[model samples]
Target: MSVDRSYIRVKAMLVSPNDDGSRHLVSRNAPTSENPLGFHRLIGGSVELGETHQEAIIREVHEELGARILDLTHLGMVESIFRYNGELGHEIVALYSGRLEPAPADEGGTLTESDGSVVPVVWRPFDDADITVPLYPAGARNWIRSSLT
Candidate 1:
């Protein structure tokens, strides 16, 4: 069998420290037919042609969460292999660490995906989240924690 080519996915991740000094994260899981096992994931997407990883992350976070990333930092990339809908998948994931600038209280934010899927976005403490849902790429939690330190 021929091996699958690498698919690149650019992700924008934010760990925001609230006034109480506790860090909260923004995550979502838009269920698609192709993704049989549903789980919440980081806010990110594919890097389009001619666009750089930084550009894609910025665009994705804005398009998906309607939030802007501030003091963005490149935390490096993580590569992994997995399966979706019984098909093997390989991804070169560009992971970014950043903080979300406070959104205006007047407007509620939303997510816009390529498939027109709407997933729930939730913010919770780092420790409180890992138990509730399985995060993709496995290394995301570590990176998120490292961002705040």
Candidate 2:
């Protein structure tokens, strides 16, 4: 199905922490015209028409990483308005906190997208360097910090 880029999209995302909660799982995003350096984002995807945000998160995690989420909790919501690949995109993201079952390797790994493209997944410290590629949706880091605390 072709997405209507002109309309705001709704997504459900999961912020899954490691065993010690020192780092979280994120997938590396490819460099777009708006982000030449690329970035990292939480795991999850769009909420299907009949599915709840919670259901969407679980389904997305399973699809992307072949894992299940435990202790799922609604964190908060974030509105993301940004440009990607030269196109302006808007989204209302529902953020959820949880743990991944059979957690990803400590050293990091890769996730295969629905489109058949593979992207690296890594455990990144919360306070990574400011100069490094940023986490998308701007205030996502803040929500993650609050959920962990």
lDDT of 1 by residue, 42-99 (tens): 6777777788888988888777768888878788777757665566676667777667
Regions of candidate 1 where Cα sits further than 4 Å from its true position: 1-21, 30-37, 102-109, 128-130
Q: Report each candidate's C-alpha RMSD, comma-separated, in the order given.
A: 4.8, 1.8
Model 2 agreement with the true structure over 34-145: per-residue lDDT tens digits? 7788988888889989999888998899998999988999988999998777778899999998999989998758887777788899887876665488787677878976
Taken over the whole model, the C-alpha lDDT of each candidate is 0.63, 0.85
Off by over 4 Å in 2: 1-4, 129-131
Question: Which residue pairs come into collision in candidate 2?
Answer: none
- Tell me the TM-score of each prediction against the true structure: 0.72, 0.92
TM-score of model 1 vs. true structure: 0.72
